[model samples]
Target: MSTDQSQGGGFPAQQQEPPGLTEEMRPQPDHGEKSYVGHGRLEGQVALVTGGDSGIGRAVAIAYAREGADVAFTYLPEEEPDAEETANLVRNAGRTPLPMALDLCDRAACDRAVEQTVEGLGALDILVNNAGYQMARDHSLEELDDERIDRTFKTNLYALLWLSRAAVPHLRKRPGCIINNTSIQAYEPSTTLLDYAATKAAINNFTVNLAAQVGQDGIRVNAVAPGPIWTPLQPATQEPEKIEKFGDDTPLGRAGQPAEVAPAFVFLASPADASYVSGTVLGVTGGKPVF
Candidate 1:
């Protein structure tokens, strides 16, 4: 990372194919490889993070393990390398790591992921719906076809519903919680990301409604709406030109690192810290307004 780019928003203009890999990114993303210190906020808990193979999911998985929680994360079959790296990080934190290759588009796969987490880890305390998809610079609505639209909804919204439905029963047993990964696009809605933005808005609605429906059962539901964090999602989804200034528009003047967002997941998953926090969107988006 250059000092000039260290300022946050002045990225050196980069790009990658859809579903980019962390290792290939310029200025490798900082997933708290050494700096995140945990104080047992989630001691003895178990977590299932979708997209845990890289980016924000990897950060959350690493943080959860350090905080004394066993972690089970899902990734695409092609993301095995990333998954292995994340598993190593979790193990180094003195916690168990169950990395599974899965396709979230399949409803059955979503159900099985939840089952595997509880069955393999002994219990389920947290579920992080962090996996998503988006195609950048699809300027015209006409350019957005049925396949892209379906894929966007299935990956971002449908899988969330499927996973949440499957995990809710287990969560009710432990009185656990669900944390969703939403985006600033939900409220801001860039024309280029029409479908992605719509799904995020739907996630926000689902989070609030589900929180209300399940509150009496002692299972909380919430979301994190990040503005512009430098992750695989950016290079994978945005145009090369756009990638150069990826998060420069934020008030903070730069994109946030994955490590910076991990703490928010920890805080929300911690009963000691957020017992009364539910149906809320925690913004980690530099300076963008989530509300």
Candidate 2:
């Protein structure tokens, strides 16, 4: 019930409209623009990261490009500004960047995204299902509306299936991988985020099953379960007061930054690093047990 005090932990009260902009955050998130270094672990590869305009997705795009992989990332319409910035960062790494503006709730959009990545970048080596939607206004199911619940399911779950299904064929050819973004909420549910937590738990199940289904194709499927990360999503979706005390309950007593979660995605996508790693949900939480 209380936030433990950490030297660099805690956020100030802030608020933003839906689909928040990174520039509007009080203490801007660190997406490894300057800190991440490449070692050519993913040379000549192409990656598709959903929700890559900002947050963990942007960090992964930056890291993937630095690692010598061309990246095609997706964003909502309102996120063009952030998407442009992400694309430029990828370019700065001397790798091609394809920034796709999409509404993943549409099945056609999901297929086209994968199609464009292969058509645009030549091949698809990694697919990151990182786009997620959640709202904090509902305290109970009685308070939850159909529109909000449907949007949550469609954005977090349906789009994952649509994108992965379309990408699997391309992934099979290159022996590529899929890295889904799950959350600690999968294990520890919050009353306000019941729908989001539900979808995340389903993602854990899907990751493991999909890995089993495609292991024969030499394709690995895994997920990253991050705890409280300092991303634009926080201020956009959470109550301002709650934002100030975020991540205090973690064993580390601090929230993680987007930069901190990118390496996990890179590790999973790298063939040499994760040749035998599949069906596993890797925890990037601050000592939170994903199990």
Compared with the true structure, model 1 gives a TM-score of 0.97
- What is the C-alpha local distance difference test score of candidate 1? 0.91
Question: In model 2, where do residues sit more than 4 Å from their true spots?
Answer: 1-7
Question: Which residue ranges in model 1 land beyond 4 Å of their true spot?
Answer: 1-5
lDDT per residue, candidate 2, 62-158, as tens digits?
Answer: 9999999999999999999999999999999999999999999999999999999999999999999999998885588898889998999999999
Which digits, one per residue and each the tens of the lDDT, describe model 1 over residues 1-291? 111236556566777887889988888888888788889999999999999999999999989998999999999998888899999999999999999899999999999999898889999999999999999868989999999999999999999999999999999998899999999999889999989999999999999999999999999899999888878888888888898887888888888888888999999999999999999999988888888
lDDT of each: 0.91, 0.93
Cα miss at 115, model 2 (Å)?
Answer: 0.5
Model 2: lDDT equals 0.93
